[model samples]
Target: MPLSRQLVLSLFSIFLALFIGAVWISVSNTKNFIEQQLSSHAQDTATSLGMSITSYIGDKDMPLIETMVNAIFDRGYYSAIVLKDADGKVILERRNPVSLEQVPSWFINMFPLSPPVRVTELNDGWTIAGQLSVQSDPGIGYGQLWDNASDSFQLILLMFLVGLVLVWFLVRMITIPIMALVKQSEAISQQKFDRVELKPKTLELRIIVDAINLMSERLSDLFGRLTNQAERYRDFAYSDELTKVGNRRAFDLAFEQILSDAEHQTSSFLMFVRLSSLNQVNCNIGFLEGDAYIKTVSDLLSEHLNKQDIDFTLYRLNGGDFALIIEGIDEVTCLDLCQQLIDKCNAIEKSEYESGTAQIAAGSFNYGDRKKAILEQVDSALTQANFNPLKWQAVDKLQTVQSNDTWREKIKALLDKDTADFIAQPIKSFSGDEIYQEWFARFPEPDSKQHIPMAELIPATIRLDFSQKLDELLVRCAFTKLSSQSGTVGLNISRLSLLKPSFQHWFVTQLTQLGAQCSHLVLEIPERCLFSDTNNFLSFIVNVQNLGVKITIERFGAQIASVTHLRAIKPDYLKLDGRFTKNIHTEKDNQLFVHSLVDIAHGLNIKVIAVQVETAQEAQTLKDMQVDFVQGFFVGAPIALEC
Candidate 1:
């Protein structure tokens, strides 16, 4: 039972016991008083009536004696009155049976009242008259007793009702704060630090409330510190100190991740830009000016690329040197982006550099490209740009790929016909137990049986502006497939599509239509998403989660602000970036990093998933770090969706 009810019942039981005792005492006293009064009344009446009838008895005036006796009998106080002769023969008698109209039969039977009879010797002028007897009727006494007890019972009931109300109030006063404390404790257990605001007056309850509030405050403070600590950890390891962009180590980690994701096959470019005036500026001006210029360049890159709605990461490899890996765009678009960067930088550096702005070199690569090969191509182009009049060049373009015109038409036709196939890849626990599956979209080449790799297809779709339609198609197809599936399925939604208000509305409507089936679907987005358009992304997440759909953050360790953002986002799953999960068994830094990430995620009540688990050793290592799930070729390979 609820505590309030239990308290009320307990107090009411005590009151009930007291009430019963009171009624018993009242009834018992009334019964005794009524009996005593009856006996006393009978004695008084007998003595007086005998004295009055003595003269009549001596004269033998039977009519007069009868008249006097009848007068007393008519008073109705006595049940019977009799006059007997000296020989013990009855001369006169008056009798009446007891009548108790007001009292119930059960009450009367439970408390039997007997009429009291009294007799006195009568005398007639010194002669003994027959004894006169008078018996008192208890009916009047019983009626008085019943009325008193009934009034007492009613008065007790009123008090009892008033006491019950007091008890209810008392219970509420005690339980309300206790219940609030309990709710606060539950929220704390779920990693939500909400304080109990109500202060109770009861000493014990108030103490408890103060204790809980103190704990919550301390925990909230601790979480804030922990989030900051995580940010520090990420920045120290991956971020450039001066420019606040990815450091050389971060770029390598990201590049390694793309290289490791052999199944998805990503196609993108590696661009290198070297400042033409940084050396001169640092020699003529101070290092502070050079640092300021580098910072400006970093900011400009972020500002310009974020507007493109393309996935890219800019990095500060070293002083006067920067690198960027831009994805989800065609070669022509990437070249155009390069030209814009060159022009924009020159416009800012007319006074600093006679040779104009920085030299830009772009080299394209696909998944599985060697780190050395991509770097050498881009670095050689960078060296060549120093001599070229334009100070910009594109090297090793994807020669085998179709032109942008061909891709636009192909992607448009495929989206128009809904001609993409989907496959499912299982994410399983370390024990090889299946947890859930993720769906991937596969598109075939337009006029060939061979399908274009995802590396090429993703960029083409984005460049052609077909990402929104593709996202819609994939989500709808997954929702349809979920109807017959027993477990949930996941789909990756592009950031470009998610930013569109129209796509957001359509996605919400589609999720609502799923109803119960929404539980069977999960949406995954890159962790880098938080670094841009975060408000819109958060709003989208709220809508999706409100509809009972799950959200997973993929490429989770990509952003330094992930810990702080995760606190706000509260995704259902946090899939670690492939960079951290690769060779986890052999990398001590990776182990420590993954362990902390897992701890932080688990602390927030969010499960951690280690992605790109390509070996049993890595899976076991991740399990040791307490990753909740693992997914990759070793755990399960992608298979055609049955439906």
Candidate 2:
């Protein structure tokens, strides 16, 4: 119960007890007072009548004696009045049975009143001539007692109401500070430090308030320091000194990081921007003018990229070569952005800096889990764009690895119709125990047996705005496949689907309906998506995990800048990108990276899974690195589960 209700009930109970006691005592006392008054009244009337009737009895006037008795009885105060001779013979008598008006039978029975009969001797010239007797009515006294009780009850009821109001007010006042403390504590749970501004008047509550305020202040300071440290580390390691954008070191980190993240590995755009003929401009004008030209291009790229609201990283690889990695974008949007960059370059004041026109080249590809491969491909695309800078052939070199208009239409039909074929890849741990089979969707070519890999098809789904529908189909099928199984089945969710409201609702509802099967399911999310709008993603993760599904970060080391979120989210598993595990035995740098990644993940009790383990030597290296799970062709290739 809430404190306010408890207090009110407690007060009401006490009031009820006291009121019952008071009414009982008041009723008892009133009954006794009425009884005594009735008895006294009867005695006085008999005495007074005896004195007045003596004269009439002495005269032997029977008519006068009868008249006196009749007059007293007619007054309605006495139930009976009688005149009798000394011989005990009744000479005159008047009597009437009394009935009370408006008094209930129950009340009269509970407070029964019996008035005493009084007899007085009448002396006729010093001799007792006759006796006069009178009995008072009990009805009059009962009516008075009943009226007194009714009035007392009304008064008591009024007091109870007034007392209740006062009690509620007092309880509310006492609880105000307590409610404030509760709200402050709830805020702290959400990582928002807040203090109790109102000091309680009670000594115990005052102490509690002081403690809450001190704790909030300490937490606020600590979070501020940690956030600042993370930002400083990001700036020093990745940002270029002159441009304040990512330096070459930053580009290397971002490229490795994005490739490591399974979610961002595929369906991303990489744009390479170069200041064309800058050396000639430096010879014609000055080094300072060339620097100005680079700065101008940097500003243009930053301004345009920031406006897109997509997750992208920018880096200045060298004086004139710039690189951009934009995630969750379609080919057309990527081409449009490339055109915008080209326009900005063409619009650059060439005469002012004595610089040649700018050259921008862009390439789109589904990451095959290879960092070096993407770097080479984008570099080749940049070379192609420079061949004809005069025509500003920036958009021509933009190419997608598996995307064409025909492929998109085919993939769309497959997804919309839910007719895509899927294959499952078995993932085995270092202990040789199969953890789960990772499911992949395949779309057959228009007229050939060749099928499009998921890496190529997923980007199209995202670009086409129907990733949610495809994800729903995939989840349902995976659940159906694992219905009677005792082992876990894992599948990747579309990043685009995670961002959609309708998709989240449908996914959560489906998982709930899966019942026990949900417990045997593992879901994969790309780590790169955690860098921006993380609250929504975290909420999504929690909602699904609440249904007993395990959540793992695919390509765990993809975006190092947002690694702090891992501690807060605590995902069940972190899969190291395939690039890191490809040749782990011979590559010292890769081994070192895996060692650090495993250490961090273990510290938080998050198990690490190594991907693309191609050889026995690489698997041994991963085990030595303390990797918790391993997956590759060396262990086993993806095979259909025997249903």
**Could you give candidate 1's per-residue lDDT for residues 113-204 as a string of tens digits?**
88667889987667786898888888888888888889999999899999999889888899999999989988776667888889898999
Compared with the true structure, what per-residue lDDT tens digits does model 2 show for residues 553-598?
A: 8876545535458756768889986656766799776676667677
- Candidate 2: which pairs clash? 257-558, 260-555
Top model number, lDDT: 1
What TM-score against the true fold does each predicted structure earn? Answer: 0.85, 0.69
**How high is the lDDT of residue 279 in model 1?**
84
Q: What overall lDDT goes with each candidate model?
A: 0.83, 0.74
TM-score of 2: 0.69
RMSD of 1: 3.9
